[model samples]
Target: MEEYGYLWQLALILMSTKFLGLLTKRYKMPQVVGALLAGLLLGPAVLGNLLSGVVIGGHHLENLALHQTDFIEHLSEIGVIVLMFCAGLETDINELKKCGKASFIIAVLGVIAPLIGGGAFTYWFLEEGWIEASPDSSLFIQAVFVGVVLTATSVSITVETLQEMGKLKTASGNAILGAAIIDDILGIIVLTIVTSLGGGKATAGDSAPLWLVLLKIALFFVFVAIFGYIVYKFFKWWRQRDGKGMHRHAIMAFVICLLMSFAAEYFFGVADITGAFFAGVIISMTQEDQFIASKFDVIGYMFLSPIFFASIGLKVDGDAVMSMGWTVAVFAVLLTVIAVVTKIIGCGLGAKVCGYKNYQCIRIGVGMISRGEVALIVANKGIEAGLMSSAVVAPVIIVVIVTTIVTPIVLKPVFMSGNKTASDVPTTSKLVENYEQREKIGKTNR
Candidate 1:
């Protein structure tokens, strides 16, 4: 029964997502937020308690168990891959090159600010005075892990907001996207170094030295730099041969993404999501990037993405959150506030350093504020290792949820409420003209 229960889970996920998604869209929210709520609605946090055995369509949700469904969890994992893949696909390499110095500066500062600010706040939660049972070193690792978690920017929510605001192509938006991607890569590197040094109980820190870890990281990048180039050249050749049809290109796109994803985890000990993201970046450097992005969008946004967003809500342990006590709760709220502030300041400062107008810097910072899958995944790794307590998990999840929910809701208004718009984003006529020129250029290249 469990083996076949994913069918019911799929039905409910899609139904709840579209229904709730429509509601969010109506309220001018990204569909991603609604999809998350849909997951919550049908997950153990909500539905499991309310309608555990209630039968509908001759299927008992009792048999589906979306919150802990192993099958659905795997599907949701793929959803992350798809999300990262699409991010890579849509990333404008030319824009990144044009904005290279600024983007790199922003990404570095964005990461540092979170690590410093979030780490300090997280240290408050880690103090032996607060939780004496955990070791001091263990607590330090957890604190570092928390800061590492905060460094992650899911960007999918921000992507939706920017797309809606017609800011996806704006200078600030490109900076945000580039910085977000850079931070993911940097965050992964930080996690690798920290975890290898025994930040989590599941890892053997004493067994591996710092030099060896750094060496492996260096080797990983050398491998990426080399192989990534080969893959890039091959895809460019494939693009030239793609006039016959795009079906094969689509298959190759997914395959390449999966291959890179597997290599990231299997070989480099990095998150496969990072590999998947690079795979998309590889594609984005091509003539067919937009086409590939749209193709994946249909399959990803329509199908896989809903499962991923919904799965997040399914993990909500309301009981755990409740039992965390007021102290932990206060800390959680503090952590969330810090997460917002650090992102705005850190990333904003980075943009300012690049000579962006003060408002544009603010926009970049606000855009980078959200934390999603990466944060949760980091926390889960810590909890699995016993380095992080279950008591802490609740607060961490709460923080992720609050930040994710708030990023989209506040992004546009922050941008729109500011003045000097006509000179900022492209006017409608210019936008149309630019689109036509790109289309013509795209055709000429083809």
Candidate 2:
């Protein structure tokens, strides 16, 4: 009976996500929005509790305990790993190299400004005794948590928007993509620092050694670099062999994904997604990357990604939001604005200083404003680590959702206008010669 109950819960989750995802697509919004709504509708604040006591043919729904929620959550975490892996796989190394200086400057400012702003805001509120936590709770910990939230800039939406606007190959698009990749790395480091400070067990003075933390991160990448090279060589040799079909290539890529994900968690103390990303990156070095990426994309978009977004909404405490009332609303708005504005000012100023045109700077800044799964994952980790409260997590979730939704809508027009102007300009012989020269240099390095 218990086993059957677990199956029923899983069925409900799948059905709800599929139904909501289809509905959202019909309205032209991201499928993620619909999936999240499904969770909200099915969760305790809505129909969940009312349906809690009801049973089908005397099979009590109460038998399906909340423990099943853990299954959904774990599945969602896997979804994140695969999603990040896909992102890394799609990244073009040459494109990133073109935006090198601008991307670095923007990424640095984007990280630093938010860290200071978020930390300052937390210190002011905590010092004023505004929160309900123990007075002894470390302000530094809370500030670090805020900084962590501010550090992420999810590029999925931005990339899609640029592609839709036909500006994906443009300078602004390249800068945005490069800056976003940097933002993800910075976010991970911030999370590592904050998690280390909190000591993982909520107790004081159990913090990991700084050297150990640095070693863990460094070693993870070193393993990836070395292992990645070996795998590429093996794949090249395999391609030279008689078995060069799709089946052989797919199996090899899948194995690499699993192995890298395992090593990341078990050996490096970094997030499994980080390892998965490196796995994808390594696989991407192969000649068959385009084919493999297409296969993974179909599976990821059709199923795993939607389930992950829905799970976030399901895990949220609707009752807590209502109970907190105005505080949650105010915090969500304030945090969302800060998250968006700081990224723009930081990345925008950096782009301008790096000699990009005004519109190019704006586009890059807007591109860095979107936050998605990465923010949610970090927030969830903070909750589990006891460094962040439910109150804090809820607002951060709201900020991520809002930024993701707005970035595409906001960036499209700016990108489109830029494209129109560039298109109207005639390609003179001198311009064509310069373009060919640059392409030659780019190809030579590759």
lDDT of 1 by residue, 97-151 (tens): 5547787889888888888887777777667445322342466777777788788
lDDT of 2 by residue, 93-210 (tens): 5544554777788998988877777767766655665433323247677766877778788776776666556566566766776777667666666675566445544545555687
Q: When superposed on Cα atoms, how far off is each prediction in RMSD?
A: 5.4, 6.1
Could you tally the backbone clashes for each prediction? Answer: 0, 0
What would you estimate as the lDDT of candidate 1?
Answer: 0.72
Off by over 4 Å in 1: 1-3, 49-65, 128-137, 154-207, 239-242, 351-364, 371-401, 404-446
TM-scores, one per candidate: 0.78, 0.80
Query: Which one is best on TM-score?
Result: 2
Clashing pairs in 1: none
